[model samples]
Target: MLNILRYLKKHVGMAVLILALLCVQAYCDLTLPKYTSDIVDVGIQQSGVERVTPNQMRDTTLEALTLFLSNEDEALLRRAYAIEDGTARLTVSDSATLDRLDQALSMPMVALYQMGQQGMEPSVLIQQSEQVGVDRETFKTQLRTQIETMADQYGAAADTMTSQMAILFVRQEYQALGVDLDALQQTYLLTTGGKMLALTLLMVAAAITAGMLASRVAASVGMELRSQVFRKVVSFGSAEIDRFSTASLITRSTNDIQQIQMVVVMLLRLVLYAPIIGIGGIVRVATTRTGMGWIIGVAVGVLLALIVVLMTVAMPKFKKMQTLIDRVNLVSREILTGLNVIRAFSREEYEEKRFDKANRDLMGTQLFTNRTMSMMMPAMMLIMNGISVLIVWAGAHGVDLGTMQVGDMIAFITYTMQIVMAFLMISVVSIMLPRAGVSAKRIQEVLDTPVSIHDPAPDKNRDESKGDWRGEVCFEDVSFRYPDAQADVLEHISFTARPGETTAIIGSTGSGKSTLLNLIPRFFDVSYGRITIDGVDIRDLSLHKLHNLLGYVPQKGVLFSGTIESNLKFGGADITDAAMTQAAAIAQADDFIQAKPEGYQSPIAQGGSNVSGGQKQRLSIARAIAKQPKVYLFDDSFSALDYKTDAALRRALSQQVKDAAVIIVAQRISTILHAQQIVVLDEGKVAGIGTHEELMASCPTYQEIARSQLSDAELGGAGA
Candidate 1:
């Protein structure tokens, strides 16, 4: 996965932007619970009275409440309020000052209010104290001392109990002062609700924007990866392609890349964001002072354990799943490509069974992994609900005992769930990471493979030193072996195919005929010796220049989907109509091409499946001819043509391309009987290099091959 992340370097700017947006989203989401707690505690419970200090109160009520305060607190309370027209209004607007006053006045105010509720109001107490011969100032001091002692007994919970009681007293004072409690509650609810709505909107926007950017980055990475893989594959020699196989490469290019793309999105969105939310939730819960942090710890531990178990059980299957998919793709490609052969052999049922077995293997592995991974969501939900239940059970006791409020308990639950969900999101992405990690390694494998064949570094001086180019290909003691092979496939081969002549190679099956031709184009480099063109080693030339100097037609007559004109002009856009017509004429394809309704404009199906085998071969030959290269290599290209067409085409080619070197790999004796040179091979070694007459008299391999295809009369006449 980290290897694949190199592709993201190109999109670093966008990825950073996504990370920033995810942070904003986490902030907004984490803030919402705080406001929710406020709505429950301050809005409904206290009738929108957020502070213990009343904004307005009657002068008599203020004076009576202040009696329970110490001299210092009483003086501070008087300074914060102004008595005018028998009503006192809070004069201080600074929030810090108001908060200080709320702390100082809460216990005294709550103690007096509770006494009043039990029929001992401050005014009643003063009257009864005078009746019992107690002075007002002494009575006030005694009352203040008793309230301080009670607060001392409450310890750390004093603030919470005092704040709750003070809010009740503030509500009663607001009612006594004719304040519209309904309007106040409505305003507070609307303000807090409005902030929550704004945060929600902000969260939604950030999430949407972050999601879009993440998708773009993932898509761009996927595109760049696909392009790199394709260009790398295109540069690969036969050795690398054989090592990876076409089916596996296809899966890597498509399925494997898709896995990386998906994981990148999750990495941007969830993986980066989960830690922020989880840590932020932990911080928020700490401030709530609910002392329920243990619940979150337990939930996280369980989640970790569950994730480990599931990943362990499913990881091997995830790795196996990719291989199974490759197998399925391999089987499917083979069946489709060989459908005709399979039917010809009446093996459709057998092929179906083969396909079914691959499909079921893939399905069975997927089912096992899917079933194992499927346990995660239920188990996660179970953990989450269990945590919620535990919090509610413990928090209910705290609420009953007055150590925690209903709103505080609710907020604690929200934060706990947030923390759990954070882990859940990470676990989900982790589950996908194993498969994606496999995919990343697969893709990186293709990208990292070294091409067995490479172009030489440029040298303008060396390039200019080579005089005029006249095609002269020579193989000097060339011994070739495929990669990892124990023995050479072609050994000690020496030959020259010079300009203005035809050199033909003939061999029994598996005689390295095609391999010899492939070396000229540097599809595979020679193992022991060198091949040269114009006295310069072919490897010294860049691939583009080397390929441009030779026209190659493969044995299979492969054609891309296009019209006759397109196929004929495939050599380059510079190929003119006249050149295309001339090449087609020389290949004996113009006659049938003119018979078609659209002639050169006719559409060709993929792989030229719409054309006959003979026509496809001729069109391929025509394409090569249109290039007007210095050398021509025909690898059994004439096998599809009948005797008449082959003879005419050869005759025309001999005349038209007389100045160019022509090398033909032929199976038919009639095809190379009149060649200027014939190289016959028995196995990997050259058996003979001579004219047909010279070979028939000297080489038994040539004589056997000639006599097998020709009667005595034909052989005599040809030799003569």
Candidate 2:
């Protein structure tokens, strides 16, 4: 996982931004519970008030208010209500308006008139109540109602005296109607609900922002990973390509990279969020004195145990799943490429069974991991619900004993659920971790592989500018063995193909014909001795310099998906139209290409599947011809053409490539019958090297090959 994160190092700022935004989201979520608790306990139960009301000092209510009123509470009232000399006073009456006393409501109303001058906050009266002589509960109920009455009449623009007088009379009027208490509770609900709604909207906005940023980062990482892997894969030589097969490399670059990308998004969205909610929930729930903290602890313990068990069972399978996927792709590619041969041989059922076996193996591993992961959510939910029930049961006693409020207990349950949910989210992401980690490791494997065929060291690199390559290719006792083979595929063999000449290699099947041609281009280095071009060891020459002087067409005649002209000009970026047409004419591809409706613009399907095998071979030859290299290597490139087309193409090529070295690996005796030099290989060694006539006379291996494909009269004519 850490290795995978190295790809994301460039986006550290974005990651930090996501973290900050997630913290904001978590704050909004965590804060909402407190508001809910406040609405229940403080908003509803306390009537959203902080001061005593005039109704509480009425003769009908004085007996109840005195019970919970402590000495400090009395002192606060005396200061806030202007109660002096054992009698509440009303100072708001004008100096000339003392006659209004008869209509001034009551003594409580008169005392409230001095609220502003007393400079007393309303909450102090309610908080300092330790000296109350009556039952605390009864006094608290009346005081809450009295405070609500004052809050009701405290209009936005009302002065202190007018608001106090209005509150006193309103309470008296409401008592007559018997509905003020319910109206106050409804107002508390509406105020608390509005604030909660706004906070909830803020949380949704923050969550959306975090999600978009995380998705962008994940997509960027995936793009970078695919690009990196592709660049590395393109540089790999035969040895590296064989070490990690084509199918596996495709899986790593596509499927494996995608897996890592998905996991990264999940980590950014959920992993970062879980910790804040988890720790914050712990702190919030811990402060509640309901004795239900143990339930959260137990739930977490069970969750961890479940995670351990599931991980233990699924981790190994996750590793195997990728390998199985590779196998399925490999088998499928082989079957698809060989569909014709399979049908010709009537092996459809056999191929089907082979594919089914691979598919079944992949299915089994996937099923195990998926089933294991699927079980997790349900079990986690069970634990969460069970903990909720347990908290409510255990906290019921605290609420009954007055040690905990019902609101506090409800909030504690919410916090506990958050804690459990945080862990649950972590566990869900954990399920993806093992599989994605396996994928990350696979992707890194390809990116980290050292190119087996790299450029020579600076000190050893040949200076191409000093001497021009005269297109002289020499094999000095070269031998090559496969990595694990006990014997060499090509033995100690020596030859030279000089400029202005044709050198043809004729060998029986498995006689190292294609292998010998591959060595010239450094597709695989010789195990012993050196192969040189223009008197310089090919290894000492930079790859770019060496390949620039040679044009090679592989035996299979591979072509990419593009226009006919695009395929011809593949490596020759500066090739002109005249040069392209001339090369096509020389390779005998001009006739067929001109016959197509689009001519050079005709599109070639992938692998040249749209063209006939012979046409593909001719186009492959033309592509090499278009490069105009100093040396041309045709590795059995003419096998698909008929005798007439092959003869015409060779004759045309000889006239155009007069000053270049031409090396041909051919199976037909007629193909190399008129070469300037012919080398006959028996097994891995050169049986004979000479003209066609000379080899037929001196080399028995050459004679047998010629006699098998040629009449005695034809052989005699060639030797004559």
| TM-scores of all predicted structures | 0.96, 0.83
Top lDDT hit: 1
How well is each residue in 581-698 modelled by candidate 2, as lDDT tens digits?
9999999999999999999999999999999999999999999999999999999999999999999998999998898999999999899988999988889899999998888778
Q: What is the C-alpha lDDT of each candidate?
A: 0.90, 0.81
Model 1, runs deviating above 4 Å: 70-72, 119-141, 152-157, 460-464, 717-720
Candidate 2 C-alpha RMSD relative to the actual structure = 9.3
Clashes of each: 0, 4
User: By TM-score, who's the top model here?
Assistant: 1
Model 2 residue runs over 4 Å out of place are 50-188, 717-720
Question: Taking the tens digit of each residue's C-alpha lDDT, what string does model 1 give over 340-403?
Answer: 9999999999999999999999999999988998889999999999999999999998887788
